[model samples]
Target: MVLVTGGTGFLGSTLIKILVDQGTAVRAIKREHAVIPDALVSSSLVQWVDADITDYFALSAIFTDVTQVYHCAAKISYQPADHAAMLHVNIEGTKHMVNLCLEHAARLVHVSSIASLGVSKNGELITEDSKWDDGADNSKYAVSKYESEMEVWRAIMEGLDAVIVNPSVIMGVGSGSKGSGVIFNMVQKGLQIYPPGTVGIVDVEDVAQLMVMLMNKPEISGERYILNSENMSNKELLDRISKLLGKPSPTIEAKPFMLGIAWRAAKLVSLIKRERPSLTREAALAAASKLAYSNKKIVDATGYLFKPVDRTLEETSRLF
Candidate 1:
């Protein structure tokens, strides 16, 4: 059986469904009463367990009959309490998973973020080799993911058969969460105008298929793959979404001065509310950075090509 941590989560749910449809025995970890994604309803034999990732002892019992594991759970949002919680789940919790995998001798596919991949200089394109290692760098979310990946790499070095997959803002085929959720809210409010920046996009369906393909391949045992479809500017992304939703695209461009005001106002409101601000300075900078990556390695290794960004974004917009 395959054990999926955070299986009820955005990407995890879609992935689990694909596995079940293929007649694979699947087990999932569900945390809350949030509506389960449409993907999970297909397989009646699939098991759903209530467990937090940080509990290693409980996980040890759970992993007894599991042969492969998909570690998709993570604490990624920018909240005040996220920092401490992230360290336990994303870092220490992953270390625990690594130990469990080693003990059980199971194949582990770890899900990470593009945030863990270090930024490029002068708007250059990045490859899988460009990973973030040092501390005192990137956002809290980035640090947590980086540390977790470090644990996986460490396990690999210590004779664990683990493969890593880092995704750039996963879109498409998910039920209003992760990057899809953020974009959903933005488009619903007629957020057509965008900041001056670019990002790599990936449809979650394509990514989930790639993960399954990777599982059957033994050559990429210790490799890390970056899953991205196409590099798109903010304007391109907004334009496509607008077209998909039949909304009026923004005519008033977002000037730097206007963004500065909005970010500052959001920061002030967050401080008074005593919470981690949504539109923080770092997040805005991350969004506005010209971050694009090459997926040639992933594509070549798995022989799975991703669909175009426009099609993926349009499909995602049509859902919610």
Candidate 2:
């Protein structure tokens, strides 16, 4: 049996449907209050269970007869106020998952993020071998993901058969104005300012397919793959989305100082509204960073060809 955490999430739901179509029986966990996506409501092969990843007892009860696990549950927040909660859910929750996977001797496919990967000093492409410095000025989200991955590595050292995937800005349909999907919405609204950064993007289907492929391969244990299809500046990416969505492309570039003001203003607004800031200092900085990731390792390892960025955008825009 296959067990999937975060089955209600964007990537997790996509992965579950793929497994169900392949005639695999899947046991997917969700938080008690989490709403099931419309796509999974009719999937007969999936057994939905109410469970919290941070609670070991809740997870332990559901691990019976589970032979394969996909650890997709994670907390992704860029605001400073959410740091503690993010740490608890991302780090401690992963600790619990790792322990349970170890106890059950199940093969694991951990869905990490490119945020956990380190940036190159000389602007070279970041691969799996790039060294991560905990002391460096990192975002709250990056630190949490890196620590979570540490738990996976610790489990690996103790003889757990596991593989990790670091996916960059996952783009696809059904995200509904959240995460990278927000970009599509912004483009539709005639967004004018573009972030001065370059990002790696991948189709959601590609990431899910690769995870299943890696899970089936016993020879690929203890390896990490960066699942990025292409690298392009935020401006170009936005332009492509705009073209496909039949919206006006962003023409103005948002400079660093402008972003500084924007985040500060958003913080002030958040304090007044008692809500999380839409724009954060760390997020603003990340929007200005220029980083490149390499998919050579995964490509060579599996001889897998990824979907083109244009094709992914086109399909997702059609859905939008």
Per-model CA lDDT versus the true structure:
0.81, 0.93
lDDT of candidate 2 over 1-320, digit per residue (tens): 99999999999999998999899999999989999998789888999999888889999999999999999999898889889999999999999988988999999999999999977778899999999987777998999999999999999999999999999999987677798888888888889999999999999999999999999999999999999999999999998999898888888999999999999999999999999989999999899989999999999999999999999898888867
Candidate 2 Cα RMSD (Å): 1.1
Q: Worst 10-residue stretch by lDDT in candidate 2?
A: 172-181
Residue-pair clashes per candidate: 0, 0
Judge candidate 2 against the unseen true structure and give its global Cα lDDT, from 0 to 1. 0.93
Clashing pairs in 1: none
Best by lDDT: 2
**Local accuracy of candidate 1 as per-residue lDDT tens digits, 196-215:** 87888888888788888888
> Between which residue pairs do clashes occur in model 2?
none
> What TM value does model 2 have?
0.98
